[model samples]
Target: MHLKNALQKYPRLIVRALVHPTGIFQQIRQERAGTVLAYGLVIVLFNLIMTVLAAVSGLTPELMLPMAIASVLTVCIGIFWLHLFVYGLGGRNGVGTTCRVAVVGLTPTALLGWIPGVALVGFLWSVLLLYLGLQELQDLSKARAVLALVLVFGLPLLLLALLAAAPGFSVAWASPGRVTWV
Candidate 1:
């Protein structure tokens, strides 16, 4: 029922989800597990496409596979971490609900990620939507909601730092087919 409504209403929902997420918060709350997973898959596909395009534009094509893999992990695992952080901060939303909000909140990123300078607009847009979505969906105070948003956006940088600091960690493209990571 909710899925049918979401599918029928997705065109308008995407706009509301990106610009004024609170307007769509109730609709997202009505989503079930399958609908949420569908949203997740859409986000993942967007990330993959963006990464590939960035790679092809001479930004380390050799590392495209690793970058794509990392993006997927970040999307999936990061959502769980976000849920736990929100819960610990006294948020009452369930994991599924948070995941739904997160995925829907990423609509801007998915749509604008292909453009270089414009992509940053999508990133910042998603960040704002995620913050508002957290507040609305989790019934959180402003402070806790900001903290949750920080965790969601900051986790990627932390992971990158860890990977860069790992033992024998190095990546360089010596040539078209010769990439080194050691």
Candidate 2:
């Protein structure tokens, strides 16, 4: 496929992922008050844990404040992204609902160090959601599902690897070449 044609097909693919035959607006209409309250509580708890961890990690007040802000932003963006993947892209209500619940339920793990263990859980969850979403794509053949999976997982990993490999990446320290603090 030509690059222009491939790029042109992407928006339709994304729209298919974002809007459902059931009507995206209607799904929002059907959400219950209790569900909203529960979601609110989850967000609050997730942010609280992240804030505490940031403070404990010795992040300066200035940095902690911004990190907390970033954490909240990440959660919000994750919600929207998952919503698009599960509801808009995936046709089955249960899969989308479960994925959303799983993402929110797992947010407390943000307090964990940014190591492979922590990152892996998030990565696996995303992969599972993509698999579920792919299963719902009536229009996509198996070859397309494989391509989608590559696009979904590969780009993020590539970017992460690039960032990690970038020059000047270093662990922050109070003193250079000294393990002990005064």
Candidate 3:
């Protein structure tokens, strides 16, 4: 029932996320956790399918099973990490606000990441949404929001770049017809 309802509502949500994120994020902030999280899962599942079928090898449950598990884990962990940074940086709101941002502010990423060349574009768009959502939805001060974003996203990326350059440690993506050594 919830899946059906979320799916039904997603068309509007997608347009809103793309066209006017601040308003939609404000709306999402008021949503219940279950519904928001369900929508997050749906987006992840849909993007995964699109990536697999449209850009990579055809639908393979074996690959999907682990990807699904990892994607869910990433979302859940990202929510907690975001909340920690948000609240620590003086966001008086509860974790639910951060959860909403993670769930809905990333809509473009979950929607457009399947396209081979546009994933980065979608990710940047999502980052902008997240920054706006932090202010509009959580009522975070500009400085705090910026700090939180840096802590949540910038720090990890910096760490990854450093790790990639470290001796005897490498990070690479595995794709169809290409085996990456890490």
Candidate 4:
């Protein structure tokens, strides 16, 4: 197929994946690793563009490269951590399936994450997609999927939120290599 036709399918895949995660994940194992990597990179590109636009408005545009780097690193780390959790929860589908689900789950946040309040909604939707997709792709029970999601994302966010909300929160030793949390 031509590159244009292949590229066109991604937008449709994004919509279809969001609406029917189970259907998409059901066939995830049959998908090629190259195609999955391309899809993930496309979603990451969307996320990077949105992040850069948001930064350009009021935040530091100078941080664009760093942000892009961090975004890619985050996806890599997220995939590994999510796969770790899925494996712990008795998921035997290997990292490729988990990788596909992770990329598919990112569609909502990648598409609309720069919209301020809508960003939260998009993030929640993305989380939901991840949860559903994990269950389907890993063949895990609902409870196990919830546990994995909570462990991978929920607890860290809760801690971060709590720390951010605390009065007079400060990180004292933030010179370089190490830092303390709130």
User: What would you estimate as the lDDT of candidate 1?
Assistant: 0.75
Ranking by TM-score: 3, 4, 1, 2
Query: Candidate 2 lDDT (Cα, whole model)?
Result: 0.45
Model 2, position 7, has a per-residue lDDT of: 52
Q: Rate the local accuracy (lDDT) of all candidates.
A: 0.75, 0.45, 0.78, 0.79
Give per-residue CA lDDT, model 3, range 25-89, as digits (tens): 76776677888777777788888777667634543433444554576688788888998888887
Minimum summed lDDT over a 10-residue window in model 1 is located at 59-68
lDDT of 4 at 162: 97
Worst 10 residues of 2 by lDDT: 20-29
* Best model number under TM-score: 3
Runs in model 1 lying further than 4 Å from the true structure: 1-7, 46-66, 155-179
Query: Each prediction's TM-score against the native?
Result: 0.74, 0.38, 0.81, 0.78
- Candidate 3, clashing residue pairs? none
Q: How many pairs of residues collide in each model?
A: 0, 3, 0, 0
Among these predictions, the greatest lDDT belongs to 4
Every candidate's CA RMSD: 3.9, 14.3, 3.6, 4.9
- Model 3 scores a TM of 0.81
Q: What is the lDDT of residue 171 in candidate 2?
A: 51
Better of 2 and 4 by TM-score: 4
